[model samples]
Each structure stands twice: as structure tokens, then as C-alpha cells.
Target: MSLPSPSPFPPPSPSAAFRPPRLLALAGPTAAGKTDASLALAREFDAEIVSVDSALVYRGMDIGTAKPTAQQLAAVPHHLVDIRDPAQPYSAAEFVADATIRVAQIQARGRLALLVGGTMLYFKALFDGLDEMPAADPDVRARLEREAADRGWPALHAELAAVDPRTAARLAPHDSQRIQRALEVYRSAGRPLSEFQQGRPGRGLRPAALLSLEPGNRGWLHERIARRFDAMLQAGFLDEVRALRARGDLHPGLPSMRCVGYRQAWEALDAGWTPAMLRERGIAATRQLAKRQLTWLRSMERRTVACDGPDPVGDLLQAAREVLR
Candidate 1:
């Protein structure tokens, strides 16, 4: 991984009135109304949105990623959405560089920048900065891919356990992509990723406030996830997956392919599963994702302002105003 260079431009003048850009990060699980709430707050503050989503960055991945529509995007200036091709790899370090430039531009124009999405790793990269880890070698990855094909992910996971037992312990046995990457990184860099993360210096992208949209009812959010998966199917999510698969770039074990809906879609394509089965599996995967997201939010040091009602837009805007003040 490449370490980000320091900003080339000089810092803003040190006038007492000079306000560094205020980033209001709206974060939460999938189907949490983040897009709706962020748009509302953008309108209220005349702010531009810089997406913090990992999946939404890919082009032609709109419906499944729950990306905002073109009309919605036209309503407000949004950055970092639909910015990369499906085959392109986007790292958190790259996001920080792109978003930092956009945020600075927004500040230069005297407008607020609202950072919104569910990708926690991106947020951490922006605030804490990334370690100067080694670059990935395609040859190494190809070799690992061949190994994984010959001997399944479980065997690879066992290999990782021997090399990086601490990392393997935390990851699920089926999390092949992460496990593979971890092992690859350790072998390539000759350093444990866990060890590199310890004692890193800070580069502050800390927001004036970090708010998560926690709906009052967990069941309501779960129902929302189920409904969203159904909507994705109606919107041709499987067709999108088929197109991606046709590219011969669909690495089933890769993180991108293993995303909630994509995993189920891949299973459907491979097993000749029915549409209903696909839908059921996708919904279950989304619920699991939501559960993990909720667990992450709970672990945050920031106290999220919970919204009690269905329409969280009003509460989000009010919270933004309070934070800005």
C-alpha cells in the first residue's frame, strides 16, 4: 500500500476566523436511510457530498450498491460515486487522497463537505491515516488464486493460521478474500499487518461530529434490508452480476464479489438456483451485513444520535445544525 503524500498546497491562513472544513460524516448499516438523510442535510447546509462507500465507487453497480440515482446526484454535487470501473481496485488510502482533495476544494468554495457512507475502513483511513504497507504483486495474487483453486479456501485458511494465527483467529473460516489478502501481505511484506497497525501517527480528518442513523427498532431495519434486496432483484441486480461475471473478472472469493447481494447472485448463477432462492439468500446476507454494521457502530466511541421515527431526515438536519454551531 502506498502512503499518502502530504498536501502540496500551503495550509489556510491562520486568521482567528479561519474555519477548517467541517465534515459531517453520516454513517450506519445498510438500508439505514443515510442517502436520504445526507441529501436533506446537504440541501440545508448548501453542502456537497463526498461518498465514503466502498461499493458505490464502482460504475454500473448502482442498484445493488443502493447508489443514489442520477437525478438525486444532479440535485446536489456528489463526489466519489461511480468513479471506478468494476475491475479496478480501490483501496482506502486512495479514497483518503481523492476525498481530501474534494474536501479542500469544498472548503475553498466556502461550503461544507458532508461525508456519508457505511464503509468504516474508509473513515478510519481519512482520520487516522494508513500505514506504509507494501504494494500488492499480481504474480503473488495469481499464485494464491491458483492455490485456492487447487486446495480450497479452508486449506488456505489453515495456511494463514500457521503464519498469522492472530488474524486467522478473528476472521471467519469462510472469509477467504480477507484471509488470502492477509496471508499475501504477510508473505510479501514479511510483516504482520496487525503489528504495522500498532503505534501509527495521526492525520486528523476528525469531523466536528460523527453521527450514525440508528433507527429505534432493529426489526424495522431488518425489514428494510429485506425489502431493499427485493427491490434490487426487480431492478435487475442479477443481470448486472451476469454482466460482471461475463468479464471473467468475477473472483468469487474477492471481497467485492462476496458483497451481500453479489454472493447470493453468484450462488444462483452457479447452482441453477431459482429467483426466489436467490432473493431469500440475498436477504439473509443483507441482514447479516446489517448485524455486523450495527456491531461496528456500537463499538464507535462517538455517541450516535438515534432517530425514533421512520423519517430520519428532520433529525439528521437538526443534528447537523447543532454540530456546525
Candidate 2:
């Protein structure tokens, strides 16, 4: 895909010796045009794009994740994409550490740091401090997986509800990966996950000047999500998943496989789901992901721009100016 020309969008006037180590974030739900807007803002401000997306970090998962095209990546310097193999796990805390270093490095080079993507959890961890939560214990996770095998994930989610109602309330009962993690934390730390989430500042924007693209019309976003998923399918999303499966090192349980479209495609290939089923389920799952993303965005403090109509990047540019000015 061709990158949008920044010529039409005039650059902002340089201020008198601006603050150093500056950061800006362009956040929105999936399929809401974040990449295009991010590219424009990064170019106008001479910013390096530091992707805040969780899935984009993993290598070889591009087609489904709507990752920036090669041409686009060549056009703008993007940090944190394709940094890890699909077999490895990336946490929000890890993202914070990597992004912090990259942001400083970009500023050191006399460029702006633009954090951009749809991963709300990573954004939260970067802007707001994370509590000293226990690291993921493999033994605990293995135990939870075994118990889930016997009693099923819904049963485990029920157990989690018993310990961490606050966390449980936000999660769906069937979300196995998160259910397993929450239970693993509770079992290993002897404390509820909710407790760790508490006492940390709620919804912060630490050094990143925040701008959000929120859809004013939910239907418009839904349509966009559906159309985008279909486009991904046509563009060989299944082939990407097939390649990952052939690696034999990855599984549906891994964080990389658990990404929205990849998860569905994996199951479809395993269970012989029809193309119609894959498209239907993939589109539905993407819409749900977008819904969860919008929910996360609403909780944070941000300068909002409507993403529905034309000139959203223009609006986002204006919002960034407001935050930076």
C-alpha cells in the first residue's frame, strides 16, 4: 500500500527549544486507520514510529495483524516490529522497557517519538506504572492447563472469580489464555490480580502526548472491521497461519497464536472450518476485539478525534498540536 503524501498536511511551526525526551501516541481501535494517521503525524513532526501494538512485535504474523507494509516501513522508521519470533512471549512490561529505551534513543537523534497502535494494554503499561506483579510461573501455568483439561476453562474462570472478582468481571468466561494467566498469578503470588492492578495510578499518560481516534458511529467501525477481515483473508491470512503451524514450535496457546485472527484461523485449519466459517468468525472476532479496544481507550485520558469521516488524520494532526502546544 502507498503511504499517504504528507505534502498536503503542512508541518507545524517549530517552537523555541522544545522539551527533550518528548513522546506522542496515536491510539485507536483496530481497522480505525491508525497506521495511516500515524505515518502522517510521524512525517510532519519528524517522528520515529514506535509501535505500541502487542501483536506487531512478533515476526511472521504480518498479514493478519494489519502490520505496516514494507513500503510504509521503509518510508517511516518504525521500532518494535518483527523483533521477536512467534514462539516467544512478549508482555506489556517488556514493551514498556523496550519502548522507553527506543523513545530516548529517538529523542537523542533529535527526532520526535511517536507511539502508535491499537494495543491498549501495552499503552497502559508504558504511560502508567505497573505494580510489581509476579512473573508468569510455568509450573503454575502447567498446573492450570491440566486443571482446565479436567474441569474446563469456564470452571477455571469460576475459580478465578472466587479470588479476583474485579478481574473476572472484565473477562469473558471462555477466554482461556487470560483465564489461565489470571489464575496462574493468583496461585503463584497468593494474592488476587485485581490487588496488583489497584494502587497503581488509574489511566495515566506519563510522558506521551496522547491522541486517540475514536469512532463516532459504531456501525461505521463495525463495517470497517468486517471489510478489513475479508481483505486479510483475500490477502493470504490463512497462508500465514499455515506457515506458522508448519514451524511446529508455535501453538494456539502461545500469545502469538492467541492473537484474534490467527487464533481463529488456527482453529479453522485444525477443525476443517469452511472459508465461509473463517470469514464469518474472523470478522466477528475482529469486531469484538475492536469493542474491547474502544473500551480500553475510553478509560484513558486522551485528546480524541473522530475516525469515521474524511480528514481524520487532519483531525488527529490538530489534536497532536493541542497536546504538544
The per-model lDDT (C-alpha) reads 0.77, 0.83
- With a 3 Å backbone cut-off (N, CA, C), the pairs that clash in candidate 2 are none
- Residues 245-286, candidate 2: write the lDDT tens digits: 999888888999999999999999999999999999989888
Against the hidden reference, what TM-scores do the models get?
0.86, 0.90
User: Which candidate number would show the highest lDDT if scored against the true structure?
Assistant: 2
Total backbone collisions for each predicted model: 1, 0
Candidate 2 versus truth, CA RMSD in Å, comes to 5.6
Q: How accurate is candidate 1 locally (lDDT)?
A: 0.77
How far in Å is the alpha carbon of 310 misplaced in model 2? 2.8
RMSD of each: 5.9, 5.6
**Model 1 Cα shift for residue 72 (angstroms):** 0.6
- Which residue segments of model 2 deviate by more than 4 Å? 1-21, 202-205
Model 2's lDDT to the true fold? Answer: 0.83
